[model samples]
Target chain A: MIGSEEVERETNPHSIVSVENLVKSYGGREETVRAIDGVSLTVEAGSIVGLLGPNGAGKTTLIKSILGLITPTSGSISVGGVDVVENPNRAHAKMAAVLEGARSTYWRLTIRENLEFFGRLNGEVGTEERKRHRQFLERLNLTEKMDDVVNDLSRGEKQRVSLATAMARDIDVLFLDEPTLGLDVEGSFELQQTLTELAAQRGVTILVSSHDLGMIESVCDRGIVLDDGEIVADDAIENLLDVLQTRVYELIVEGGVAASTRNEIERAYDVVSWVEHRGCTKLTVAVSNANRIHGLTGALVRNGLQIRSIRMDDTDFEAVFASLVYDRPHVDESRAARGER
Target chain B: MIRGRRGRLSSSVSILRALVTRNILIMKRYPLNTAGAIIGLYALFLLVYLGGRSLLGPGFSGTLGALIVGFFLFIMGNASYKTLAGLFATEAKWGTLERLYLLPVKFSHVAVLLSISSLLVTFFIGFTMLALMLLTTGTSISLDLVSILPIVTFTLLSTIGLGLLFGGATIRYKNISSIFGLVKFVFVAFIVAGPTFEEVFALKFLPLVQGSYLLQRVMNEELRLWDLEPLELSVLVLVGLGYFTFGYVLFRYFTERARTAGVMGHY
Candidate 1:
């Protein structure tokens, strides 16, 4: 039987942002684009929700509609408790967003000025709040460039300033669209750390769209996967892994190995994929039962291969997202209509 | 009762001031670009002043002086609107306008802030030119500063309102810069041609042009105070209100359209 607490958690109405049947279309004569279809989802208070989708999947459309930056052809959106269509300004009072490419800043403005502008726009924060915003900027490693023009900063630094500006308002909800699109490894990690602290310490509800599957897995409590402008999967990060029941395996063959033997091993078990690198045949096998790998190894040896190493691969979001979404049939353009639906 | 309701309406001026202050602060950080633009405006003024002297004969002094003043005003309005257009254009290009659309504030705040911020820069340039003119042209251009003060303020407001309207269009239409250029051509022509004193009788309803004509008439050594009409003053005020409302409504409409397209940031 399902636990009472589990049911309550699933049915709870404490979400910060909620949308139902959201739709958006553009253009008139000759060409029309249905950007968002019947998309419905909820982002809980203080939880980081990851929105993952391929290009042209209407992720931006969905985000814009929720923010009331765009009107929906048909749907309902509420930020906190205010309806977006009925009262967009009131609904927006609860949310702050950092859009793609750090476009939220005036290039001529200094980083400090950018923050000041956003803080004033938010209206809840006064002049004294600006002094506190400096501390936040320093924490985000933007103190050194406080007086530098926004256009002069590097792309990563510009994004940092954007985040600093968004954070200055201390809003209850934050929406980040591709926050770490082109950041280097260090920059991406630093941003992830800051997001984690913001959500954890401040109880801020965050909805993030990112290509960084690893960061999403580590930081987000739940994820919403969009395919063809529809919600394909909306579940906890752990549940997504459970749905894609596949584990990575690293195998090392010490003896001489033939390509045909590799083929024979593949014939014995579900050889999802494998790579031969530096004398090690690393295989990613999708075994229904864990014990099935032993039988596969026996078959490999009988086919004239010596197994020197066998290691169960790490279980993480990147592998799960790849195996579940990226490796699917949609990557083939022709098959898009079939599986993407 | 309606006037009371209108009086209760909140002033967005504070919002505009905050945004303008921010832009000024930003310009301070980029001193080189600001200095270069200011110097460029001065250089352009000199070129026009010297070049026009030879082309036109006796009336060159008064006409050129008036044209330069009009030119500065025209550029001031254009520059302010250009800032708004640039901000919207850049945001649309970079996908930031999408975020701003999602914010809680009124979308009008976006245009208002841009118009105010850019006007500050334009005013600085105009003031500098006025100072230079005072030093060079010792022939007292009447210097009827007292009478022209209110007219100047109203003129600036009407021009800035036009800027906001165009800025909004830039957000909705990606190639609005071409349209802005075309509109500016016609506007500058109206300002420079002095609109034939007879045209003022017809266009008394137009704010910026009417205000400019009234100021010019009042400041002219030959014109008399008895010639001024009460209807002209009231018409100028009405025209100012009209432009402000027209610009405001148009801005709100486009902002909504942009958001609905899910391309508020679409370049």
Candidate 2:
């Protein structure tokens, strides 16, 4: 049993979405697979929540169940106040989503037409609502591609159009799964910026799942890390970083040491992971403890290694993710089950 | 706040409408199939007309008109089935169904929408064949708006129901593709060689033959429908209603199962 304070700490503001003891299985004949097992979480309203999991970690399954796209074997999910399993239509009314691709819209229809279709489907498409649709398109930087068919637009442009369609729905809850997948750097940054603004300005309860840890960190307020179909770490971004903290440092050498000397210095640190690029051995040393750096560098000095500069790398976010998912034999258990099936 | 039966109904309708519109747009992108269907239907009508002329000679005129109309209905029904199944199988193959499953709307709505959108393909063909037949043959098939309207409405409803049923089945069972194809083949074959089979079986429950019988009634202007056996019309209505109910139940079942199994996005 989870305490109320723990739940509150996990879900700041107000928990608008609650999922309890969710389980999902597939292909029940001679071989059945459990995709999700006993997953539970709370997502607060007006806060961007990141549901982070590796591929086949039941991330998509969990998201679909929350949206009432699937039923749970045993458990309950509610969007707003409506139970998703019992009252899917009511639950869906409060939410919208952008999956990997833009199937929510028509392929042949122009972007504006797609928006009109979805908006009208949501009863928001009217002569009076076209302006609002246009505003959303513009906000998503999709106005330029508004008249283009989805198949005609670039991947990023199509993604923008997809985002615009969900935005046109203007629902209270938004589910974004790998929203930045298959996007270029500029497009990814642009999308991240748009999401940040949308959540901050519109008070939309957004749930995002993505492999791009950086993007999730930048756009989300809190994140839930899932492994083996269970919530392992649920915390705010700052707290997650704090929990997963590891020592990473940027090291600069005055002059290039011999490969052998560099190897010895590398042996001195726990791990020397860097490359010699642009006339600099930009090494990242992983120290067991902060005090170990003195002896670590002393070994380098004794080995005639000139250390021109060294700076600590921010290890909060990366360390948090690593700690949550890395070296955990149980995480491998999930992978093994998936592979077997 | 909008918690009630009416709210859910409206939401279902809204989602269905969205899915249908999306499918219609997909059809628009590749109008080749729609155009091919219209042309193929007209050709099929021509063959049926010629077959009737040869089989029953001048005495076949009234029956030929009815046959033509019946052929159109069967084609419409068959076409509806093909369109729905193809949409599902192809979309699943192309990995689009996963994206659809991720949406908040029910999968049943998507199935219904697929059926609705598919109607455009058959309707276009059905109307085209009707126009062409009227222009060429002009064999009075009774232009009574009253009888034609009800029959058209019922026929469309029945076709949509079957289409939904087939689409729903395909969501879980991939073999449903072949099932739909086999269904279309059997119906088309039955229409071509219905008379001999009707005589041999003497079964009144068959839709294809009954459809032909209704068309025959329409062409002869015997207009004795209200006075005729009530059970016949009731059977058709019951069959259609049965199909619709079965489709709804199956669709809801598989949708719920898919959701829980996490196979909703397995496609």
lDDT of 2 by residue, B43-81 (tens): 877886888789889887756565666666676767766
lDDT of 1 at A202: 86
Judged by lDDT against the true structure, how good is candidate 2?
0.70
Residue-level lDDT tens digits of model 2 in A1-341: 21122543354347889888788777757897777877778887888998887677788888888887677778999889779889886677688777655454556789877777767666636666798787878887777877887878888888888788777766888888898888999999999998888878888889999888999889899988876677777878877776643577787876666878767776667665767876767778787578888887787788777888889976756567767775578667756876942
- Give the winner by lDDT: 1
- List model 1 lDDT by residue over B1-267, tens digit each: 102333223224445656667666756766888778777867777787767877776668777546645755665655655666566776677555755665555678656656666767777766666666546555355555566556556666676677667767888777767766676676666555444544546565553577667666665543444456777767667776778778888888877777665556677
For each candidate, report its DockQ versus the true two-chain complex.
0.44, 0.45
Which whole-number lDDT from 0 to 100 does residue A105 have in model 1? 72
- Score each candidate by Cα lDDT: 0.71, 0.70
Weakest lDDT window of 10 consecutive positions for candidate 1 chain A: A1-10
**B157, model 2: CA deviation in Å?**
4.1
User: Whose TM-score is greatest here?
Assistant: 1
Q: Tell me each candidate's RMSD, in Å, in order.
A: 4.9, 4.8
